[model samples]
Target: MTDATAIDTTGYLALVRRKRLYGTLLLAVFAALMASGFYVADDRNAGGFFDGLHRIFDFPAEIFSEAFQNWRNLPGLFLKFIPSLIETLNIAAVSTLFGALLAMAMALLSTRGLALWPRLTPLFRRMMDVMRAVPEIVIALVLIFLLGGGPVPAMIAIAFHTTGALGKLFSEVAENADTKPVEGLASVGGNWVQRMWFGVLPQVAPNWSSYALLRFEINIRASAILGFVGSGGIGYDLKTALQWGQGKYDQVVAIFALLFLTIMIVDHFSDRARARLVKGGRRA
Candidate 1:
């Protein structure tokens, strides 16, 4: 019995050491992979990291210097770009509204037990996956080529991406919902729409609204980027100003300030709104 106990202890210690050694080897391999990837990326880059590190602030310095020299024009520049800024905001808002509505329908259709057609749930899920996988830029570029440059293309592109993203999140939330309400409604001969509208929507509305608001924030940035690549909004103006170089640096500064302020405002409001939504949801 003493010898058996000794053998068991020795085996246990060996197993533990083997596991530790394997874990260490895995970590070492991961580190090596990361190091190699960074080296490869650096090699392929047009400018080396260390080479550009010091000059990183050169552009910002130039913009600030020019803006300071022409500080009086900042307000005028802001007003000039206000129309473009509105276009950007409109694109984001319209896309979010349409996308959230579409996502709500898709979410209900894809969710188990809530689905009107359970067999087609997989189909709707795959459709959302495909929509999500296709980046906003790709759709924007394609639509731009086909329809010409405008906010319409950007709006559609962002909406498509938002639908897929929100659909998945909304469906996940629906899955956790209490089916008792739905069951009770159905017992009273409620149709699918009635069951969902009267039952699921109330439970999921706050979370859905929160997600939509967050998507609105992301869509705003995406719309601006799309505008730069296509045409329309402050991004296009920024791109144009950038092309003019030193002489138009003031305009560039103004654009940056506007973009920064807009983002800050949106982020602040969205944060507060989300907090309120979560608190309200918990209370309900």
Candidate 2:
């Protein structure tokens, strides 16, 4: 190779080494901070799990014993909460659908070279950052206060959070997309929407869909938690059952079973869907 080519390769290697060093330093700093935080939390009695390590299973034992005694009531209790379970499912499904759609639009808008109004990209980026920075429960509580407690609040909160998360992921995937198609479309006088729909979206669809599917599974759990915190859905029923204590423990068990089964099914479905999307699928 020429001396000039040798100098260029040396510069590239130096840049790579610098990046690796920075990454290592950042990771070391993060680990140090985490270690210090844990120590401080333990000192302040904020580490309850560590303090109560021996008795961790005490509550579970009591719950299981009570649930066992009322085994016959489990089926009835489970059936009773089916409607509430359905409500939770609806909340998750609706939020995911809307969130995915919003995320797609935002992803296209925020991504470099893909955005119509590229100058507004930074504004959209900050907007997504704010959305994800605020906790979903915080949003849910605000909505609950304004609109009253119900599935609507949980759905909106989850959707808002999902949009931020999925938007971030989708934008990253879009960034690595082949820009040639976009340029081609633009050269042919295709509008921004046409270029995105025909050029950008087709390339990124599978990855985006995979991320959305995983987010949907996560939102199911979020919906249940939000429902318990606010109102409406099986989580609210679970809360009520727990509040009633011993006599209603069986209902709690039923709700737990339903939640577990539902999560399991969704997880399996998401895994299969992702495999099909990214791997050309396995033959059954």
Candidate 3:
């Protein structure tokens, strides 16, 4: 028995050492890959990191100097851009709303056991993957050409991406849901819609809402970028101001300030809302 125990202990120690060696090797490989990638990226970049690092604050300094000198114009500039800011916010809000609605439906349809048509689940899942794979810029640019540049194009582009993204998240959450409620509802002759509505929705609502809110924050940034591409938002104004150069720096600063403030406010509210939702979900 003593000899057997000694053999087992030796084998266990050997296994542990092997695992540790493998883990260390993996970590070393990952570090080497990261270092190589960064070196390649730096070489390919327009401005090398070391060269740009020293001047990193130059642009910000110039902009702030001008903005500070023209502090009196800040309020007027803010007022001037309020409408565009509103348009940007509207684009994000509408896209998020539509996306969340579409996501909810697609998620339900694609989820296993919860799907109304189990065979078609793969089709729906593939559709979402395609949607998510396409970048908003590509869609927005295409829509801009077809639709002639407006908030609508940006809205649709963001919504399209959001739908796929939120759908995947929603489906994953729904997959882990307790199916007892769904079975209970179905046992009473509930239809597909009824089963999902009474069974899946309640369980997934909080998580779904949290994901949607996070998507909204991302969509806001996307909408702003789309605006730069001519989708008509604060980004368009910023682009125009940037083109004018020197004297227009103040306007650029104003737009930057507004965009920054808007992002901060939205981020704060969404963070709190998500926290509340998650907490409420756990309690339920």
Top TM-score prediction, candidate number:
1
TM-score of each: 0.93, 0.84, 0.92
lDDT (Cα, tens digit) per residue for candidate 2, span 1-284? 69999999999999999999999999999999999997888788855756689888887888889999989988888889899999999999999999999999999999998898999999999988988787889999999999999899999999999999999999999999999999999999999999999999989989999998999899999999998896589989888889999877788888999999999999998999998987756465
Model 3 residue runs over 4 Å out of place are 281-284
**Candidate 2 to truth, TM:** 0.84
Candidate 3 or 1, higher TM-score: 1
For model 3, the local distance difference test gives 0.95
**Residue 91 lDDT in candidate 3:** 98
lDDT of 1 by residue, 2-52 (tens): 999999999999999999999999999999999999999999999998999
Q: Where is model 2 more than 4 Å wrong at Cα?
A: 1-39, 46-51, 282-284
Candidate 1: global Cα-lDDT?
A: 0.94
- Cα displacement (angstroms), candidate 2, residue 189, comes to 2.5
